[model samples]
Target: MSDTLIEAGKRTIELEAQAVKALGERIDGEFAKACEMILNCQHRVIVTGMGKSGHIGGKIAATLASTGTPAFFVHPGEASHGDLGMITQDDVVIAISNSGSSAEVITLLPLLKRMGNPLISMTGQNQSPLAKAAHAHLDISIEQEACPLNLAPTCSTTATLAMGDALAVALLEARGFTAKDFAFSHPGGALGRKLLLKVEDIMHSGNELPRVEKTALISEALMEMTAKGFGMTTVMDGQELLGVFTDGDLRRSLDQGIDFNTATMIDVMTAKPLTISQNRLAAEALGLMDAKKITALVVEDDQQQPVGLLHMHDLLKAGLV
Candidate 1:
């Protein structure tokens, strides 16, 4: 039974793989025209379909929106009931139906035609009514279904989804859509945090900053670092930054027989220490710390004044490392 199940799984995957490969080879002038129509659309692309194709359409729409092309899915069943209003004159419609004759999707054709919306169709049969009516038709036709019965929507739906992804990626390249642009669309996701979370957003600022006077005793800087739990402290003269004192510096000072009770920050601090701009991404600060083999950084402003402190713990807590 185990062997039988494994063989079935492999056969199903093999059939689907061949179906997708065939779909890839079928890309031609029609695909180019479909891409051009979508690129020229002044507004969003409205994707619609029934059943399994509808599920695929929703994902395709989401992928397009995230990748820079604005798009959304509409249920063909709801279009006749008032959802047709969601499509605007400048919008493009992508209708998906493996058989190319989904009744509910076909019913929206006359309405979309009246609204002057361009139509792109994904169908298994090129000669079907929906395909014939489309401004550009994508042939998602497959040799056979992955289902043993050859009666299910498996291979055809997979082909349609692959074609949708191809179209979205092509449009993404054409638009020169950038990583920064994608970050804005997914600010709450991990990629957004990596690309958008800045030093100021995660740094300990204001009263939480570890600071001591340039003339302060080494013991006093140690106390400040301990109180702030940042493993380091800034040595400042009014609004000007003189240098930074860290646990490493303390170790080196003690090795040199320096007295913490009398040695001031001027004698024990590391001057001209590495600092980061508060406006820069925390990822940059993380990189700097990793490259320097250090654990903390002083967050500075445009005036080069220390405004905050960032530690490796901050990056760990922010899920950037």
Candidate 2:
């Protein structure tokens, strides 16, 4: 029985994968025309569908919106009552249906035509009413369903999803959307945090930064480091960064039997320590620290003067790590 279930799962995956793969070949003049219509649309793209197709339409709308294309989803059933007002003559509508003849969707055709809005249809039946009425038709037909009974909307939904992804990605490339643009739409996600967060946003500023002059005694630097709780201190001369004294440096100095009261910070500090710019992304700082095998880095300005300090704990707290 276990072997039978495994085979059934494998067969379903194979069928769905093939269905999605076939979508690439279906892209031709019709797909191009659909993209052209959307790119030239002056208003938002309104996606409408019923049942399972509605779920897929919602996801496609979200993908388009996040990838630099302004879009939203409207249910076909709701459109008949009052939601149709959401769509204007300037907007473009994308209708999804497996049979291309959903009753609720077909009922809205006359009103949509009166409004003079262009229609883009995605359906399994190219000759169906919805496709026939559309300005452009994107065929999402599949050979068979992944379900053993062939009644579920498995393979067809997979093909439709793939087609939607292809359209979104094509539009994304044409619009020259960048990671920074995507971050603006998804500020709460991990990628957004990595792209939009900077060292200055989370770095230790003001009195939180431990600092001591090169002429200061090693004991004095250690006291400052302990007070700051950062396990390190920046050794500087006025506004210029000289080096850094860390816990590791103290351990090595202790092995040398040097008196903490007599030793200067310069004698125990590591010269030319790794530094990052305040404007740089915290993700980039994480990479630099990981590569250097260090826990902290000095944040500098354009002139290489230290302004703040960033620790690995900051990245963890920001959820960038």
Candidate 3:
């Protein structure tokens, strides 16, 4: 029984893979035309479909929206029931139906046309009403379904999904969509934290920043480090950043038989330490920390003065690690 199931799964994968490959090869000037229409659209893209195509359409709309193109899924059935009002003249419509003859989706054609909206259609038959009516047609036709009985919508759906991804990616590149732009659209997730979070957003500043004067005793620097809980402290001179002292520096001083009580911060501090700009991405600061084998960095301003401190724990708490 297990052997039979495995064979069925493999067969389905092979057939669907072939269908998707064919779909990729079929991408041509028409695909470019569809991309151009969406790119030039001044407003949102309205994706509509029925049944299985509806599920794929919703995902496609989300992908487009998150990738810099504004889009939303509108059910074809709902659209005919006054939901058609959701679409406007400025919006572009993408109606999806594998057979190109879903009554619910087809019913919206005249209404969309009357609204003067540019219609893009995804269908199996180029001569189908929906295809002929579209300003640009995306052919998602498949040679056969992966279904053993050849009745299910497996291969066709896969092709439609791939085509949607292709359209979104093409528009993304044309619009010069960046990771930061994607992050703004997905600001609540871990990906957003990594891409949108900056050093200044979470860095320790003002009273939270650990600082000690260069002439202060090493024990005083240690006190500041302990108070800040960063295991490090910045050593400053009169109105100037002098250096930094870390737990590692304390360890080395102890090994050299230097008393923290007698040794001054200027004697034990590391001079010319690495500093980071506050506006830099947190992920970049993490990279620098990893490369330097350090746990923290002093945030500096353009005028070359220490303004804050950033610790690795802040990144961990922010879900950036």
**Residue-wise lDDT of candidate 2 within 1-321, one digit each (tens)?**
999999999999999999998898889999999999999999899999999999999999999999988999999999999999899999999999999999999999999999999999999999999999999999999999999899999999889888998999999999999999999999999999999999999999888889999999987997899899999999999988999999999999999998887889878899989999999999999999999899999999888889899999999999988
Worst 10 residues of 2 by lDDT: 258-267
Q: Give the root-mean-square deviation of each candidate in angstroms.
A: 1.5, 1.9, 1.8
Candidate 2 RMSD to the correct structure? 1.9
Ranking by lDDT: 2, 1, 3
Candidate 3, 49-78: lDDT as tens digits: 999999999999999999999999999998
**Candidate 1 lDDT score relative to the true structure:** 0.92
Model-by-model lDDT, in order?
0.92, 0.94, 0.91
Q: For each candidate, what TM-score against the reference? A: 0.95, 0.92, 0.93
Candidate 3 ranges beyond 4 A from true positions: 188-191
Off by over 4 Å in 2: none
